[model samples]
Target: MDSFTLNKAAGAVLMVLILTMGVGIVSDIIFEPTIPGEPGYEIVLATPEDSTSEVEPEPDVVPIGERLMAASASAGENVAKKCAACHSFDQGGGNKVGPALWNVMGRKPGGLDGFGYSSAMTAYGEEKPEWTYEGMDNFLAAPKQYISGTSMGFAGLRRPEERADMIAYLRELSENPMPLPGQ
Candidate 1:
């Protein structure tokens, strides 16, 4: 391009930039007060325990493994219904959204072949090696928290009894249920 055209283009760009900055400055002055704590809006924070219709509070600090000893497999079956959408408990059950969970106890995380696993879960398997009732219990308590970036999106079984029951049911999925904690 000729120098004249180039200079015109540069001038036009500068004008647009100047106008953009001017608008930004004017908006800031209008939206934000010169003194602090005088913004266009005020933020209201909810006090602790102030929520209406309080939901179930988290259970006690008991170790999940100990809780597993009292876990009811029948109770777990009901919990398993939620899992049924993503996993099949029967032996040789094919992969669904999640891998077939048969014999998952003692199995490596993301162990199933051809079932795509998130990198976090695969890495977790490498770090943890094998699943014990304790590990599984923690994971079931909060799948995403235990293994961030994991493909499993389940929020987790919050109740200790519910988690134990689910674990008990999962134990039955295997031909050999691993020894319960403190057995």
Candidate 2:
């Protein structure tokens, strides 16, 4: 309110600021921090060219047909459960997110009439014609990779046995399941 009171308050504020600065300076001198030349831990990544360790060769890939011989439709039915969310395995089940997979084996890719197919899948169908054991196998392994622009969101079955089982189960969905490969 008055000049004396205002000056005192201003002087108190200035004194507090000076005290804080002085403490910081004195603390810095007393406890000096040693800065490292390199900040954090150095991460050494091994590139193929620089790597000296021997890389193991990939395992021998058994043919899909041979894998199918040992595959069980029951196990495949379980795997197909995931497919059930997108596709209907039963005959006349109709399309869900994906076209009904009833009798998908030997059927043309993008063959389902009612459901819309991706241009990539239509193009793939044009290229491949029908879904052969090998074609289906590859498609089941990686849908997007098999058909680059396909709308299929499924990541696909990574395990060959699981794919074979799924194919086996799908085969059974029809009136006459296609003869298993090598049968």
Candidate 3:
């Protein structure tokens, strides 16, 4: 209310504003990239002496059948949590975002009567008669990549063992479990 008080408050506000601007300016000066094009470091990749030699990548994972032979249904149940949001594993379970996967191992892809499937999935089913072990492996590895234009947004299981376990769990979901790879 007094002139002196008002003047002091105004001066304090101005000082704070100026101090904030000063810190911002100093940080910009210190952190800004010094040179435009220079990465400031070099990445050197080693090359083979014989350029003509073709290199084949060694496979890191064994076949799904081999993995399935040792797969664990209990672990598979845990992995199924990822799919639980979209599919129902119980027999007579209703479809969710994706169809109910109850007894899906031997069933045709996109074959669930009530659930709608993407065109890509329907066509993939036409070409591939049933969800064989290997087919399940490939599809579970990369659904979108395995069947282009598929609507499944799942990133697919990356571990071979996990896929096998998931397949094993799915196998048991059926009233009549399909034979295992060796069985």
What is the alpha-carbon lDDT for the whole of candidate 3?
0.84
Tell me the spans in candidate 1 whose CA falls farther than 4 Å from its real position.
1-59
lDDT against true structure, model 2: 0.83
Collision pairs in model 3: none
| Candidates sorted on lDDT, descending | 3, 2, 1
Q: Give me the runs in candidate 2 sitting further than 4 Å from their true place.
A: 4-59
Model 3 per-residue lDDT tens digits across residues 142-166: 8876776789999989888898899
In model 2, residue pairs whose N, Cα or C atoms come closer than 3 Å (at least 3 residues apart or on different chains), thus clashing, are none
Give lDDT per model, in order. 0.82, 0.83, 0.84
Question: Can you list the residue pairs that collide in candidate 1?
Answer: none
lDDT of 2 by residue, 78-129 (tens): 9988988888888889899999999888889898899899987887788767
Across residues 1-183, which tens digit of lDDT does each residue of candidate 1 receive?
899999999999999999999999999989985666765778886553553221233456577677777789999999999999999988999989999989998899877787999998898888877887777777887887677668888999877789889888888988888888777
TM-score to native of every candidate shown = 0.67, 0.69, 0.68
Query: Quick one: best TM-score, which candidate?
Result: 2
